[model samples]
Every structure is written in C-alpha cells, then in structure tokens.
Target chain A: MILTDLRGRYQFGFGRFMERDYDDIPGTYPLDSRTYRKGYHVNMFLMSLNDAECRDKFAEDEQAYLDTFRMTEDQKSAVLDRRFLDLLKLGANVYYAFKLISFDRQPPQVMYGQMAEPRLTFDEFQQMMIDGGRPIDGNRSVEEWKDG
Target chain B: MAKLIAGMGTSHVPGLGAAMDNGKTQEPYWKQLFEGLEPLRAWHRANTPDVNIIVYNDHATEFSLDSYSTFTVGVGENFEPADEGWGPRQVPSMSGYPDLAWHIVESAMAEEFDLAVHASMDLDHGFTVPLSIAYGQPKEWPAAVVPVCVNVIQHPLPTALRCYKLGQAIGRAVASFPEQINVGIWGTGGLSHQLGGERVGVVNPEFDQKFLDNLSRDPLANTRISHTEFMREAGCEGVEMIMWNVMRGALEDDVDEVFRLYHIPVSATAYGAIILENK
Candidate 1:
C-alpha cells in the first residue's frame, strides 16, 4: 500500500505539473500537495532560520523557539531530534530542513549522511560520494530493489 | 540592438559558494572541481557580457514557502545576497539591469507568458554561485544581471517544455531590445544529487553526462523528459535541470559548445558545467 501511494504520485501527470502519487519510486520524497499541506508549519518554522535574530533565538532556546510555531508534535519532535528523514515524512521539505542544518553551521553532507539508507556517518557519506556516488542500479524503484 | 552571445549551464551547489568565500578552492577536497572550472573562467574573461540573465531557483531563503511565485524576474536596481542561515556570503551585490529586465518582462507578457515581477529579491547561492564560478571573486561583477527565478521547491513546478518556451520568449525579448549590448543567459543548479529521503548520496554521472549532450544537441527531447524520469534516473533534485532548458531555449538551435566539465560528488552533487554560444 505504501509502495502504491509512492508510485501513484508519478502516474497521472499529463506532461505537466499534475498531482500524482509517486511513493513507489522508493527513497524519494517529492513535495506534492499532500506533503506541502501537511508540512507547511514545520517548513515555515525552518524558513525562519534565514533571519539572524531568529537564529540567535533558536540557538538560545531550541525548544522554546520551536514551540512558538504551530507545528505538529511529530514535526517538532522530528526537528528537535534532527531526524531528517522523519521530518521529511512529517512533511518537511529538505530545502527548508536545510535551514536548520545551516543554522547549526553543519555542512549539508551531515544531513545527507543522516538521511542515507542504512544511515552513514559523515565520513562514510563523504567516502561514498568520492567513490562515484551511490549507484542508481537496483535503486530506481521499490520493486527493482525487491527483485534484486 | 543587444545580441544574445552565449548561454551557460552549471551546478550552483551552495558548498561551492562556501568554498569560494572561505578561500578553500585550492583545498584538496575542492581542488579538482576548481581546476576543471579554469577553462570556463578564461572563457568568461574573454567574452564577458554587458548583462547576464541568470535563471535559477530560490531555496526558501529569499522567499518563504508562505507564498512562493512560480516564475519571477527581478527589476530592482541592485539585489543583496541572501542570508541562508549562515550569514550571507561576503559577495558584492549584483547590479540589476532594469531596462533590459523590464523589456523582457513586457515582451514575455506580450507573448502570453505570465511572469511575476519583483522589485526586490535577495539573490541566493543559486544566483551567486554561478557568477563566482565564472568570474571568481571580483570586486563587482562585470555584467549587470536580470534574475529569472523558477519554482522547483513546491510541487506543480512548471514543465520542461513550458520553461523552454519561456526561454524562447526571453530570447526574442532580449534580441528586440534597442541597446547595443552583449547579453549572456545562464541556467544554474542540478546534475543529480538527491539530498532527502534514503537516497542522499545519489549522483548519476551517466545521466548527468547524457543530459549535457542532449541539452547541447537535442534539447527538444529534453523538453519531453518527464519529472518521473528525472526522479527515477537522476535523483529527485535532478529535476532542477529543467531550468537549463530555459538557457538552451534562449539560444539558437545550433550552438558552439566551447567548454564542458563534469565532476562527481562536490559535497553530494555531480558538478556539471558547460558554455554554449549561439552559432
């Protein structure tokens, strides 16, 4: 069923930007209308990090700063935990979630590492990237990986 | 009349911008990438345009998700570099070419392409990194700019074909301008590197190289590459390559491909750069 939902997102576009279910693509979280609607508040909170004053406040009291936004409990927890993939599942766009990463002065690779399948440490992620990146073979779709 | 002399396509990875600002271009990690770009820098020195039309996407830095516009052009006289969490990079503010910008906007609208015009836009890495790569750390950029922002963040992004057609309209708009000026259009970002979900370190060199070839030789075919294929083959973020179509569409059908560079995993992206001039 989850696979169907992912696959459906990409199924219905008429050579234009129509809403389609694309969950079957596996390992990709496209910011469709559904995710956009769900993750709006969390993303808004993330976007706030663009301002210096907001960054100072966020750095001063992380929880209190996050509490000001009307994000869901899952969104808040995911953000607080630095659970990047969970934040995405909770509707946080990676670009917005990146604001939080940027605020912490961590390179984006840290978040990329955390978001990797089987999760990589920063060093492992860098090494994988150096080794010509994760191969697209067997990684295209859920069914491809399953069959492989 | 102003002539469209060249078009460029390159990845505008934020890390590349950071590398330039921090004087880390020669660091072991970034040395190869910088070395690959020397030819491009030399090319820029030889044929610097009077004005550059930069087509890029804002990454929720300058504009929040609260209200994101699909297609926007900057008409402001100057644009400040946006502070994307880390303090804004210490780069010179870009001078906006209002006359040319307004001309393109009016001409595009007249041609039935609806475009949002912003008098104020904080230029992000998507806008600045390309300049840095081409011109290095200049006190002020040699060329004035017209920023064309595309929506790649939210869903319902403008299709590849739509972006291409818009570029053609912009090309007509630029050519019709009465000033004797040289103009360069650049499409920045992408070359496959997914940053989200379980596919973080993905970079398809095969797809990235082929994309460059098709973009140079068979761009109309690229206009038909669906969003699904971009995600499935090039990674989700690879969809950003649609903006490159805008640069291609603005140039003549047959272009002289002068310089091309393809490198893997600058941070997480397969950095691809090309300079094409209309033949």
Candidate 2:
C-alpha cells in the first residue's frame, strides 16, 4: 500500500536549445553516430578478431581475409599499411583497433605515437607518458592550439 | 514489491583499475583520488543493498563494433572478468540476478523501451573497476549485480533525455517485480576528460563541478543538455555522461547527495564518483 501510495516521479526540465552539429574539430576523426554508420563494414571486419579462426585466416592471407568483408579500398589500404590514423579516419574505434594492434604484437602506445604530430617512436611515446602525459594546454584542438 | 534504494555514478577509467590492481593507492598521484572513494566504502560498510543494477558502457573489450546494442541486460547466472590482452584481474566472479534481470527486461520492453538481452559477455574495466572502488578487492562482490550495458563508445549515443526516460522505465520495472528486494542503480563513466585526438588530457574541473552540482541538485535540467555540447564543452568522449542520467532517473524525485568525488589526471581522464539515496 505504501509503495502504491508513493509513486516515483522524475523531473524533466522541458526546454529548448540550439542543438549543435558535431563537425568542427580539425584533424580529429570523431567516432560519432554518422561515422559508425559509414564505417560499419570496416569496423565489423576488425571485430572478427574475437574468433580465433578468423585471426588465423588473416595471419595466413591478409588480403584474401579482408576480401571476405566488403570494406572500401581506402579501409583495405589503411589496414594493409597498419596505418592507425588512416583506420581512425576510416571509422575504426581505438578499442576495436586494439585487436589489430595486438595482432601485430605491438603495444597500444604505438597507436598513440601514430596519432601525434611529427610522430615519435614507440619508445619515445612510452617515455613521454612516463615524463607526464602530452601536456593538454598546447594540444587541445587544431583551432585553439595552433602550434600543435 | 521491489524497491529502488540507491543510485550512484562513477568513471571506469582503466588506469584506476591498474592503480588498485597494483596497490598504488598511497602514491602522490593517486592518494587524493583514492581518498575520495572513502565515502563509498563507508556507505557499503553499513547500508549495503542486496543487488546492484550496474549501468555501464562496454569499452570494445567484449561487444566490439560488430554487434553494439544500445541497451543490454545480462540475464546470465554469473559474469566473469575478461582477459583483455593483459590477464584478468584477480577477482571473484560476479553473481547475476537472472530473475531480476529478466523481469526488468520484460518490464522495460512492456513500457516501450527496446532493451536487448544477453546471457553471456565478458565485462571490462568499465564494469569491474567501479566494483573494485566500491567493494574493495573482496572475495566476492558485496551484492549481486544485474549488468545493464549501454553503448557509449559508438557515436550517436542515446540522447540525454532518452537515457533519463529509460531510467524511469527501469525504475518502474524494478518497483513492479513480484519479489521484494533492495536494489541499487549504478551508472559508471565520464566526468569530462577526453582520451583521443590532440585533446588528450582536457580535464574540465569547472564543467565537472557544474555537472556534479546539477546531478545532485536538479538532474531534470540536465536531461535537456545536447550531445554536441557534452563533446565540445566536456570533451570528445565526455558524452558518456548520459549513463548517469540512467542512474538518476531510477530514483524518486527526492534524493540526498550522500557522497561525491571528483579528481583529475587519472590517466588522461577526470574521474568522478557519486552516491544518491532515496530520500
């Protein structure tokens, strides 16, 4: 009786604001909803690493393996070249990209190093993190932090 | 009838897991943030609930880009931690409340909220790290968990309003359960820190504080926030704040801010934690 008498109520402050579009940041590939839709094939193909059989097949014949999935020529090239940024631009999420990195037996810092301007070696990237993460002030956005 | 007793939110920064796993709580870098979790420790010490409906996003550890479900409830018997390249954390398996999970799914679906069902899936730090923070490295989780996985990693996350409404539906579902049980809702992730791009360590304490104030004072107003604003003002990945709405929406309109924590530089993230009890 007490439960029924006391009903739950949620306050939703109904209002309006100019909903903004997510398309400003330069040199950054946002894994936003649209990107997910556009890069669906490429991302799913990478996701297949969860299965040992697929991983074995990819190890044997990279192109023949990629052919099984209908990815774009650009995505095919990005994966072929082990281009982390290229894959990111083509719609691969960092976490899913980890599978690809692990397949290459490389640490994730390799991908991090790949993203930075004037790309550093895997060792340089690891040392930088140890020294202190890439300072946020100068690397915020291409528009805000022009020097980066 | 089942009753909703508490709602809380926190970040699932994998580094926090590393800290706890490696026992670096007293280090200068981690000392303050580790101290922030004392309130949760105290709360659990006393008023521990029987079950926690953990609402967290999967970080590509399990559900990869292939089959990402917007909202999924784990109705399996137990959830074991994942290997995730590095070996699994030394923690006991988490017990799942299948009866409650299935009930919530049915109730949520009946209310017109499409929720996916999962019998088995490896949970990553997003789910496990918060467990470590709240329950410590206990032999077992202090309470049974009904894992509710939300897809925040993929772009085009559910609108803040939709997350709030989904929480409301989950609250109703929990309340309508025939079995009587004390349930706590936990939403984990995000307090304004971006991991990717040039903006690697953007810790917006100002934005983080306002988020805490509003989440504590008036979450209703929070639902009106747009995803673009969260990404821009908060950070590219800061939009993960939507998961908190699910936690807040599960509570009664009246709640008390029992405890809250906010710290920065938790490995490229501004970690945040909060506890809200039905007042």
Candidate 3:
C-alpha cells in the first residue's frame, strides 16, 4: 500500500499588532510589548534597584509604590481612561501569546499568512493555511475534502 | 501454503493525514507531497490482494493517559471513528474479521504476548491514516483489517525488541489461520519529529534515513537501538519507529524494497513510507 509522509509545510500564528505613531519623549522608560500596546509608557522604573527587594518593600506599602511613578495629568488620565488597571488585573494572556509564538517554529510564514487574518474561523483558517495559496475545490464537502 | 507477501514501515503522523483531510495536498506546494505515494498505490493494486494487519499507536485518543496498555488488538465487527476535536473522518467504518482477528489474538496470547483484545473501539488517526493511504476510501475496502494498536504515548511503552517479537508472533498466527489469505503486516509511526513541549519542531532526517535503511537490511540490528537512544537521536516521538521492527521481524532477512517515500512538511514532523516484498 502507498504511504506518504506530509509534515512541516504550514505555520499558524496570531495577527500582527496594529502600528500607530507615538510622540517621542526624552528620558522616557522603555515599555514591554504587552504594556506598550495598551498606551502605557510606564517603564519598570525600578530597574536600578533589586527587583525582589523592591517588590518586598512595595508589599509593605502598596500606595507608596504607586505614588513613586511620576506621571503627568494627561498620562494619569490615560492610564485610568480605559479601565486599563482593571484589564491588567485580569491577568496577561501569556498562554495565548505562547501558542502564537509556537507558530514561529512551523513552516515558513507565507504558507500561513492568510490564516493570520482575524476574519476567518479556526477551521477556515486551518483550511486556508493548508490550501497554501491554492483555490479550494467547490464540489467537495468539508468531510469529503478531509478523507484520505 | 500461504506466505507473507510483503512488509511495510511508515510514519502514521496524525498531522500528516490530518493535513490531507484539511485540504493541504491540493495546494501547489503540497502537489509533490501526494505524488510520492503513487508508486505504493500502484504496488498495492498490482500485488497487495488481501488485508494488511496494521500495527500502530492510538495517541491517547482511544486509550486515555489515565491508564495505558502496551498492546491491544481489535476483534470487533466494526470500529467507531474517534472524536479527536475535529470529530470522525467521513468514510465507511471498518468491519473486522472476527474469526481471523480472534485467532491471532488467541495465538499471540498462547505465545506469551499478553495482548488486550477489544470487541469495540473507535480507532484514532494513527490506525486510520495508514489504512486510508494503503486502501483508499472505497465503498468497501478490499481487505478486512485487523488493527493492532500499540501504546507509544505513555511512558514505559513497549520496548523495540518487544514489538519485534510481537511481530514474529503475528507471523506465526497468520500462518496458522485455517483460511488461506494473502496477508501483509504494516508498522506505522515515526522517522524522527517531536510534537510536544518546548522541543516541538525537532527533526532528525539523517537518523530517520539510516533507520529506514537498516530496517530493510537488518531489522534485528535496528531493533537493538534502545528507546533512550531512539528518543535522543530521533526525538522523543521518534521512539514510535519501534513499531516498524515488528513488521520487519515478520519478513525474511532480506526483502525487496518496492517503494520508499520521505517528506517533511509544515507540521514540524518527518513522514516516511516504505514497502518491502519477500525476496
């Protein structure tokens, strides 16, 4: 009987981040990818200090740690503006992003680019990725198309 | 006297078969992918007249991680399609040859294999993928399949030599059957690719090629490769290649290599297919 091994051809990942223009400010703290997308220019600020010790000190007085970060009225308003703290409290999407990054090790990016679009369903995205820039046969049902 | 016709070794990578069902083969990039199987298809039509007793792993679909058996055989009339997140594939469910299947089960037991016999089960992609490739989705497939599902997913899985000996038992059982039938044994899964955890995309093409070559010439020698070494050289999942030794042990020392196909696609796994006929 015929046997064919088909592995390592398609990659799957999350959509690209939306790019936007941000005004450059001197001495501004670098932002992590997660916080940067949320319009927070906050830096770790405590990079110069021992992170564990600072965290322990902060644990003693939480409000003092919050007041330590110097912020302008506009920055404070923006931070509170979108319920950003509440969202941060909801926890980071490390699992989701990790799954996306896993795609990096798969096949080339072009094979799965169409799947990166937000509009497609997971199955449709999988099908589109597998199609790999080819037209799907109109006649075959989803089940028919899948049978070996 | 009924004799062993051929022995085949293959990778029953779930994603490879899943890709076919997912319409991956129709893509231009994958056009060359399915073409590799043409020779095997031709060989099957010309020479493989009856059923192939497929040796494969269940990937924890039929047998959960809670408890795992080393080896299981299907002696049931029909097998259900497993729900592997995407539900079952659209095809006629396989009907077992209970008489033939039970005979082998009994024979293997008598021979000290301690095989678990299943009266009812839904075979996962591991069993079905090779079946689909060997025998297309015919209204009724020519061969009456007797599935021998191995447990490779769980730790303390069957040893390479153990699977090889099981194959020898299978050969004896097939030969003892009252009805004369042209039977072939198939061993599926692995030629090096890891599909889990941080080391997911690992591939060892060199080891895979060597394993296939050694399998054809000196299967016993190939079976000597340890599970630890197999995992180290072929990746953790590569340990599944042990199943091939089972098919190899069933055949003569030197078999004619009919066809061999190897491909590595987007799934971060290595795919291999080989058919060897008795010289």
Candidate 4:
C-alpha cells in the first residue's frame, strides 16, 4: 500500500508539498523544509566539527562523538563509512556534510566524485568538469527526457 | 552622505581560498583562473572604496542548522576567519565598520526589511574567498567591511525578488549614511555548479552567461527567475545566483561594466566575476 501510494504521487503528482516534491527534476535535491527538519540532528553533528574541541573529540573517537547526537543508525553508519551519497539520502545538508569531508582531509572534488552516478575518481570527475560539466540537455528535468 | 560607488559579484568557491592559501594560484591547474582575476585586482587597486558591503552566505560555519537566520547583517568591529572543520586559513583578521553597519541595518529595518543584526560573527570562505580574489592576501585588508550574510544553505531561502529588494534597501541605506565615504557592494556566489547528489558536477555555461549578461542588460530578468528554474538549468547550488541580484539591484539601472570573467571547473564551480561602477 505504501509503495503504491509513493508511486501514485510520482505518477500523478499527488503527494507534492513544496517545490522539492516535484520528482520531475533529475538528479537534484533541494534541502527543502522537510529535509531540513529530518537532517537537523545530523547537520548539527556535522556542524559541531567547526569547533576545535569537537574536531579533536570526533577524530579521537568517531562513534562516541556521533553518539552525542540523536541520529539514526543509518546516518551514523553513513558517516562512519564515508558514504556521502547515502548521507544525502538520509538528509544531510551538503554544506553541513562538508565539515565531515574536511575532517577526512579531502577536497570537495573527492566527495563530488563519489556522489556522481557512476562514482568517479577525483581525477575522472575533474576531467569531466573541464570537458564541460554534465551537459544540461537531458539533465535539466526528468520530464523533458520523457517528452523527448 | 556616503556614496555607493560600485557593485560587484563573484563566485566565492572555497577552493579558490585553498589555492591562494597554499600558494597554488600560479600552478598550471589554477593559473588561468587566477590570471583572469588580474583585471579585477587592478580595478580595486585603482579605485579603492572606503567600505565594502559584501553579500555572502554562511555554509554552516558560524551559524548552526538548529536555528539558522534568513538574513544577518554583521555590525561588529572585528571578525576572525572561521575554522571550517579544518584549522582557520592563515589570513589576516578583518576590520568591520559598526558605524556604517548599524546605519545599514537601521535603514533597512526602516524600509521594512527584517534583517537580523549580528554584533559579532566569524568570516567564512564564502565571505573571504572573494576578498582574496580581488585584493590578494593583504596583511591588513584594504577597506573596512560590513558582511550581509544570507542563508542559502537551508531550503526555502529568500526568493530572488526578495533578495533584490533587500539589496535595493541596502543601497538606499548606504546612500543615507552621514559620512562622505565611498562604498562598494559585493554579492558573492554562483555561476552554475551543484555540489551534491548524482548531478554533482553540473555546469551550464549558457545559463551562467545569460545570467551575467542579464545582470546589466536586463537586471529584472534575473529577479523574475524562480529558484526551481535556477536549479533546473544551473544545478541545485546554482540557486545561489540570486545573491548576484542583490548586487545588481544595489546599482543604478545603467552602470559601467568594468570587468567580467568566466571559467569552468573552479573545483566543481563555474567561476564568474563582474565589476560594475555606478555612474
């Protein structure tokens, strides 16, 4: 029943709440109000890394630090595994999640590379960007692709 | 009365700050982008403004996600660089103009723009990288600064029309100040590039160029663009282009476009910059 409802919303645009509910946009996630509420604790945990003390504690013991926040087990595991895309799925704001990337001593390109559809290496992602970032032709909207 | 002399916009990508801090600006990968900044650097050197009101967004550095503000005007006398997970960048502290800042806040409030007045706030890459790009690494920043931070990170950010109106209010605020100082308004961020999701590395040059062109030729064109449209064409983060409308709205409808530059892949960003002087 839940799956049917979800598919119904996608097909008929019934469950739409805000602009973000429009599934017609391809490969885009706007940190909408719902996502903001859901990601609050996780983002708070990530935002805490801004402090030197929090950074030290988090570096010393990742699990213990993550425990300070009331995050879902999946969110915690995503952070632990450096699964950036999964963290996004679990409602991690990209700006907040960037603190985690910095803690790992990686440039943003590395994280962006990991988030790509096929999962590119940093070099591959950099090359793709130089060659002119993912073309806007078929990428703009999922609806446009269907129309084509 | 204080005069609004110039309005400018640029991408405040953190990687540009990283390159400058690590002395990589001249390296092959960074050389062209840095070289493109020479004209803007020269423009600043030739015509220095007494104060710079910079419009930038905090990326979860000083403000946490718990209770983020929609708009914040920095009214402090001094600001330190924020430590964004990593240690703070080795940059000199900045001087803030409380007198001018408070005036702007008051005037804006009088104009019915409900801006959160902040007495103290740390400067992040979003605020400082543009400074680095324009002024280089000065031991002491050349001009006093007043930071106007918008919350672009959270969803349901201020609409393009709203931000533009805020800029118009700020422009009036700066003009009403008692001092005879010259002021520069800068809106930093965006030229198409998403930082997250499977569509992370998207960059639409056509969309970005149209944005740059419309900023002067058809300033209201940008004000009419919806956030959804920005996301569709420019990428999710491309919605940041709305900030540039603030700079454009602050300027006279007709102004001199002093310098403009655009480049691709500034660390997953389509780097764009413009300097416009009020006639």
Candidate 5:
C-alpha cells in the first residue's frame, strides 16, 4: 500500500513507546506540505548558499546572517552547529539542506555517516557500500523489533 | 523528419561538476569518475546530435512549493545555469529548441499526458552536471536542448510507468516534427543512494549494475517497481530511476548499450551511466 494510505486515523493503547518508531526507517523524510511550511526560512537561507558573497557573510557572523531569515532558533542553531541531522528533524530536505554541507566544504558522505545511529566511522560507512549495502534485515530497528 | 538517434543516462551529482571545475579529476577521490567519462566525451565529439531532450528535476532552486509541476516542458529559447546554493558551474548557457519542445507538448497532451510548459527555467546542477560530464566546459553547449522537468523531490512522485509512456509519446512527437534533426534524450540523476533520514550514504552497486544490464531489453520490469520497494531495495533517492524510463521509452524497445560506467562514493552516491543507441 502507498504511504498515504496509512494516513487518516489510528487507535492507541498500552506500551511505553506506543506510536510507531520511525527512527529506524531509512531514507525517508517529511519533505511534504507540512514540513515545507515549517522549514521555508531555513531552506531560503540554504538556497542563498549558492552565492559566494552570501556564504562569506554567513561564515563571518553566523547569528547575524541567520537573523536575516525567519527561521526558528533550532533551525538557526542547526546552521551554526552544522547539525544536519537536527536540521532534517526540523524539516530540511536533503537537496536544499545540502547547501549547508557545501558551505562547510565537506563531502556529504561525512555528514550522513555522522548522523547514523550507532554512529559509523566514515571508513566503516564507505565499507558498507562496498560490501553490497547495509543489510536490510535487523538494521531496520535496534535489537529485536521489525517494522511489522 | 526529426529522428531520435540515441539515449543515455547519467548521474548529475553536483560533486562531479565541482571536480571538473577545480581540476580534481587527477586527485584520488575523483579519478575513477573522470576516467569513466572519457569514452562518453569522445562519443559526443565524433558524432554530435542536433538537440538533446534532457529529462531532469529541479532541487527547490527555481520552483519551490510555490508551484510544483509534475511534468514540465521547456519551450523557451535559452536556459541559464542556476547558482544552486554553491555557485553555478562555469558552463556555457544551454540552447533550447522551441519548435521541437512545443510539438512534444502538443503531442503529449494529445496522448493524454498534460505536460506543464516553462517559458523560462534556470538549469540546475541536475541539468548541467551531465552536460559538463559529456561535453566538457566548452565555449558553448554543442547540442541544443529540450528540457523535460519532473517533480521527484516531493512524495507521491510520478511513477516509472507514466514516465515511460511520456517518452513513447515524445518519440511519436519527434518523428512527426517537420525538420531533419538528430535528437538525443538524456535522463539525469541517481544511480543509488539515500540523502536523507537514517539511511543516508547507503549505496547499492548490485541494484545499480542490474539496472544497467536490464534497461535495454526488460525496461518495463524496472518500471513496474513500487515506490517502497525502491526505497527499501535501492534507497529513497534511488527512486529517481524513473527518469531513465522516460529516456528509455523514447527509443525503440531494442537499444544497443554503447558505453557504461559504474563507480561508488562520488560525493555520497553510486554514480552509474550508460549510452544506448536505438536500433
């Protein structure tokens, strides 16, 4: 079934983490109508990273630069801290969010590797791709939980 | 009569364009990617196509959530390379063919595919990186272009089957055009890798290679793939494979694989490319 089909309503009861743990789901984001609205200012600042002059201004004084946009403190701090993973949580699409990574003059592989829970070393992550890929089984969630 | 001569697919990862710009091809990280492009560069030089039908998507640079079109046809006269948050590649402005673009638009509408028309569009790295990869940073882009834009970033992206059908309609449109032009359809983006969420840096060479193998004869099998399956088996961004179907379906079902390259860790993705000449 399409993901949209899983929308509408759901009933809940009982255990501690009752809601689905979406953390284990790989390569998905809320880059749709809702997230777009939330992250517009953050994304706008990111888009400005295309300009060399803008990047210079941004790196010079991070707070004053980000103040130009209407982003939340979290979004502004993410830009300052280079918290790419946190930025995603606050609704940054990777395509637009990558401008931040570019601003730092770092390859995206570094950020994604750092974001991996259980946090992989850059070498360990690169090795994963070469060894086919991260195994689909068990890796979906920590310990014994499957998506089902 | 206008004819579709060949079709090719390339990853338009911005890192490749940067590598070419900074002369980092000789460096260890980019050496293999530059080496892979050598044959493709020669192929374009030896024989040039009059125009290229570039199938690519914008990365929130030109079209934001303000107005998103699922399928856009550029019927403009010229396209400027956009500064996609990290400066534009120093490539020449791309030439566009309005006559051919409009004809395809009309034909696609006639075939029940309502393609949005773009009078002005800025070509992002998704559109220009492939140009830099194959043509080098020439004074002017040798081949004229017809840009076919798709919406891939947002969820509920257009499916592979729809893209393939659009390519077939485009093929019929090209054949009916009243000009003696040799055209190439280029699909750009994503061999396999996830850029967002927990699965970032996940690259699958197996899925990438098999796709290269099966694209010539068994394309519909690739098109029949579900979105979640691609997310699971290939990764989220790997769903960009639908763009290749648009290129493949434009050619005849039988295509000869001319040149192929598959390399890993180009920035963060598995970059795969292949040149297929229609038989």
Candidate 6:
C-alpha cells in the first residue's frame, strides 16, 4: 500500500484542534533560524539515504556525511538522536522527520497528542497500504486498530 | 478606454507541459484532452490580447518553505523559468512589462494591499504552464506578461477573500494605467487534484465542477472554501485554485464562458481550463 495507490479512493480528515491549538501559542516554542537550518539538513540527509549507494557512503563516514550541510547545534542533536535513527531505519522519509522536529518545538505531550489521529485515516489510504502489501501495523496505534 | 479583453483561468499543473513536451499527451487517453484547447487557440488569435496579468502560485520553487510571503509581484523586466528537478521546460524565457507590473504594484499599495515586489524572480509551473498553454512556444510570447506568484504552498496562505480583494486592486490598477492596452487576467492552477505526501493524485471532479460553476456566478461563494478543506478534497497542491478567484473577482459577474476543458489522471493532477469574456 504505497501512498500513491490511495489516490481517489478515500476522503481523509484531521482534527481541526491540532492546527488551532498550535496557532494559539505562536512563537512560544518557535524554532530559531538555527534549528530550522538543521531541520533542512536532516531533510537533505534523509533524501540522500534513499539510495543504497548514498547509504553506503553515509555508513563509511557518518561525521563527514553530516559536515556536507550547514546545520545548527539543536538540529544536529535531533538528527543524531538514537531514537530518530531508529525511525529512519524503519523507512521514515526526511519530510516526516522534518515534521517531527517541527512538532518537537512544542511540548512532547503536544507532539504525541496530535498523533492520536492516524497519519492516514482514509479508507483509500488503508487500501493503498494493503495493496502494496506493506505492513501498516507498525504505524498503527492501539486506539486506531482497536476495532480490528 | 482600456478594456478587460479576456479573463482566463487554468490549472497550472506542472506536468501538463512536460507531458506534452515528452509526447505523453499523444497517448490516446491524453490526446483528446490536449486537443480540447483548440477552441482556445482560435479564440486567442481572434482577440490577440496585448498583455496578460497572470495570477498563479509558487511551489516552494522561487520561495522556500522556511519563509513565505502571502503575495508577491514581479516587477522585473524578465523572469527565468525555475529548475524544478526535471530541468527548465524547453521554452523561451519570459519578458515582463515592468512599467505595467510596477503600476499594478503601486496601485495595490495605494489600495492598502501590501505586496512584495521582486526585481529578479524565477517562475515555477504556476506561471509557466498557463503561459505555455495560452501562447504556445512562440519565438517570443505574443504579449508582455506580468507574473503575480502567490504563496499557497506554505501554511497560513492568504484567505480567499484577501485574494479576491487583491484581484479588485489589480483590476483598478490595470484600469488606471494611462496607456491604452488590451489586457487579460489569467488565473492558473487547480480544478481539484492534490500532489503531496500520503495524499498524492487525489481528484474531486464533483467539487471541481461545482467550483467552476459558482466561480462564474458568485465568486464570493468560493471564499467559503477553507484551506484545510481544500487540501483535504483537492489534495495539498489543489489549494492553488484560490488564484482563480482573483481572475473571477476582476471580471464582471455575468461573464460568458468562451472556453472550458478538463482532464483527469495526468500524472497526479487534474487539468482544467476556462476562458471568460466580459459582457
């Protein structure tokens, strides 16, 4: 079930509260320019890792791998975080990680709170994942899969 | 008196021209759709507008996601086509009418619409697709173009009402110009299809048709469409359709639909075109 296969199959909806809540506290935890740059670097790094050749290049010299981009201290920390690396190994894309870092700017509870809704809630999304024969269980939540 | 000769609205789908350029449009399914523009071709030749004020969106190509502006006006004499990974389209570079563009900018400012003006700017699919479709690959485009690239990709984009207001300002600006010239306002992008993460290639034909219908009669009805709802139904990129309201607002309520066409499933986008003539 690749994301592409879900096209035109289902209607997806997100809780409006997520954006409303985020807007209410503007700049309370805004990412400084430094953190934003690092986030972009992380994005580029993830893009690079998409290919086996690039992954092998990264494995050979991880430090040099990071040096190629201009990243800030906090961005570097977030990218180098062991937890994030685990997510990367599981096939999360750079855009996803950048979103996670953006969420990180808020409190951890707020970050996780928004995930109450599945990333792909539409039936079309589920059908695509199923057709692709990709495991959706890993991304599913106890609340989301409880009916099944 | 200078007149609003034509009102054009089109989907600025990045892949449309690329599809045609690469001979994808020759495929049976696409050929019929591409040929539908023949009527517009005939119409354009007959009217032969001297200038077009094109309103479109920038897909994080000229402007980054890091910082976004609600509205930007190109006052530069020339604009370079953006390199959107697939490389620039094989088309002649576009020259801008700075005098006209700057006049619009100044007029917009006078109307209290704070617009960002750029001396040197690169245009993405938003501007290029409509131009390519309307004028074709001419030795040079038939008329001078003033590119108005709206920031619809980033979060917190301008509201539909604001965009409509900007159109009024643009209309006023174009009318105030001392030089008499036949001008067209071309609005591009979206008849519903989204291209983005997770929800790529979504199309809502029903909504799209209804939108085009309402747009012709009551453009203000379009303002009721929320950003999230647009992203949800039309797909993330489909939100770019807001630019069409600019064209609609600038035109008289009772406009004749001179031309209309729609094509679906074109590399993850729905392609559409509409030409409205003022009564």
TM-scores of all predicted structures: 0.95, 0.82, 0.65, 0.95, 0.87, 0.72
lDDT of 6 by residue, B152-238 (tens): 755567888788888888888878888888899998888775332323334677678878887877788998888756655565466
- Over A12-125, each residue of candidate 2 has an lDDT whose tens digit, in order, gives 221122122655543455675556776788878777765567788999999999998889999998999989877887877766776787677675667767765557676765
- In lDDT terms, how accurate is model 2? 0.79
Model 1 C-alpha lDDT per residue in residues B128-180, reported as the tens digit of each score:
99999999999999999999999987877899999999999999999999999
Whichever of 1 and 6 has more TM-score, that candidate is 1
Clashes of each: 10, 3, 9, 0, 3, 5
Best by lDDT: 1
lDDT by residue for model 5 (B171-273), tens: 9999999999999999989888777776676666777788888787788887887666666566678788889989988999888999998887676678889
Off by over 4 Å in 2: A1-20, A32-34, A49-82, A100-110, A117-148
Error of 1 at B82 (Å): 0.3
On the 0 to 100 scale, the lDDT of residue B70 in model 1 is 81
Provide the global lDDT of candidate 3 against the true structure.
Answer: 0.61
Q: What value does the lDDT take at residue B24 in candidate 2?
A: 88
Q: Which pairs in model 3 have colliding backbones?
A: A7-B265, A8-B265, A8-B266, A8-B267, A9-B265, A9-B266, A10-B266, A146-B21, B12-B189
Error of 4 at A39 (Å): 1.3
Clashing pairs in 2: A32-B155, A33-B155, A33-B156
Interface RMSD of 4: 1.3
Candidate 5 has an lDDT of 0.81
TM-score, candidate number 1 = 0.95
Per-prediction TM-score, chain A only?
A: 0.84, 0.79, 0.24, 0.83, 0.73, 0.35
Q: Which whole-number lDDT from 0 to 100 does residue B65 have in model 6?
A: 38
What value of lDDT does candidate 6 attain over all alpha carbons?
A: 0.64
Better of 2 and 6 by lDDT: 2
What order do candidates take by DockQ, descending? 4, 1, 5, 2, 6, 3
